[model samples]
Target: MLRSLDVLLLIFLLVTAIGVVCTKDLLGAAIIFSAYSFTMAIVWQQLGAPDLALTEAAVGAGVTTVLFLIAISRTVRREDE
Candidate 1:
């Protein structure tokens, strides 16, 4: 049962990763990336690595997402053709 949950999380992570890459909107991509990072943190926690999970939450989901949002806000929203 636990292993199945882990597998589900992995699948979610993969989907979020693809969403991040495939989305044309920068803000949407950043949000999806944050979701990906959060899923990774959950996986790390489930794998018995609280420290790694905390790091991922702080760095990947927290700092990186904030930075991406800030950068996106500072720049234009639409992709240039």
Candidate 2:
């Protein structure tokens, strides 16, 4: 049962990864990247690495995504100009 869930998480991770890669908008990509982090956290927990999973949940889902958004905001521009 647990292993099955892990497989699901991995699948979700892959889908989110493709979303991140295929997206042309920086903001959209950053949002999907956060989803990637969440799926990764689940995979880590399934692998019996609670510490690493929590780290991913915190940093990957939280800090890293925020940083990516901020960086994108700074470097990317809107077409309204």
Candidate 3:
């Protein structure tokens, strides 16, 4: 069950990462990146590194996502043609 959960989390991380890279909208990409970071935090937790998982969640998902959202709010949401 644990291994299966890990696999599922990893798959979500991969899909979110790909979505982040493939997204055309900057805001959407930022959102997906945040999801990727959150999924990574879960993976770290499942791997038995609680400290790393907390740090990843706080910094990678929380702080980084906030920063990205702030930047996105100040700029255009879409790429210029």
Candidate 4:
């Protein structure tokens, strides 16, 4: 069961990473990147690294997402303009 969950989480992380890379919209890509981080945290937890999982969740998912969102907000312009 644990191994299967790990495999699923790995697949989810990979798919989200691809989505982040393939997306043209900056905001959408940023969100996908965050989801990738969340998936990674789940994987780590399944691997019995709770501390590492918490760190990944906080830094990878929280801080990274905030930074990407800030970047998108600063660089993106109105599509109408």
Among these predicted structures, which one has the highest TM-score? 1
The TM-scores of all predictions, comma-separated, are 0.91, 0.87, 0.89, 0.88
Record all residue pairs in model 4 with backbone atoms less than 3 Å apart, i.e. clashing: none
Q: In candidate 2, what are the lDDT values of residues 1-81, reduced to their tens digit?
A: 567777888889899999988888878889999999988998998899999999999999999999988888888833232
Q: Give the higher-TM-score candidate: 1 or 4.
A: 1
Candidate lDDT (C-alpha), each: 0.93, 0.87, 0.89, 0.86
Estimate candidate 3's alpha-carbon lDDT, on a 0 to 1 scale: 0.89
Candidate 2 stretches greater than 4 Å from native: 77-81
lDDT of 4 by residue, 1-81 (tens): 557777888888889989988887888888888999999998888888999999999999999999989877987823323
Top model number, lDDT: 1
Off by over 4 Å in 3: none
Off by over 4 Å in 1: none
In what order do the candidates fall by lDDT, top score first? 1, 3, 2, 4
lDDT of 1 at 15: 95
Q: Across residues 17-52, which tens digit of lDDT does each residue of candidate 3 receive? A: 999989999888998998899899889888999999
Which residue runs of candidate 4 sit more than 4 Å off their true CA positions?
77-81
Cα lDDT of model 1 by residue, 1-81, tens digit: 579999999999999999988988889999999999999999999999999999999999999999999988999665452
Candidate with the larger TM-score of 2 and 4 = 4
Error of 4 at 72 (Å): 1.0
What alpha-carbon RMSD in Å does predicted model 1 have with respect to the real structure? Answer: 1.7
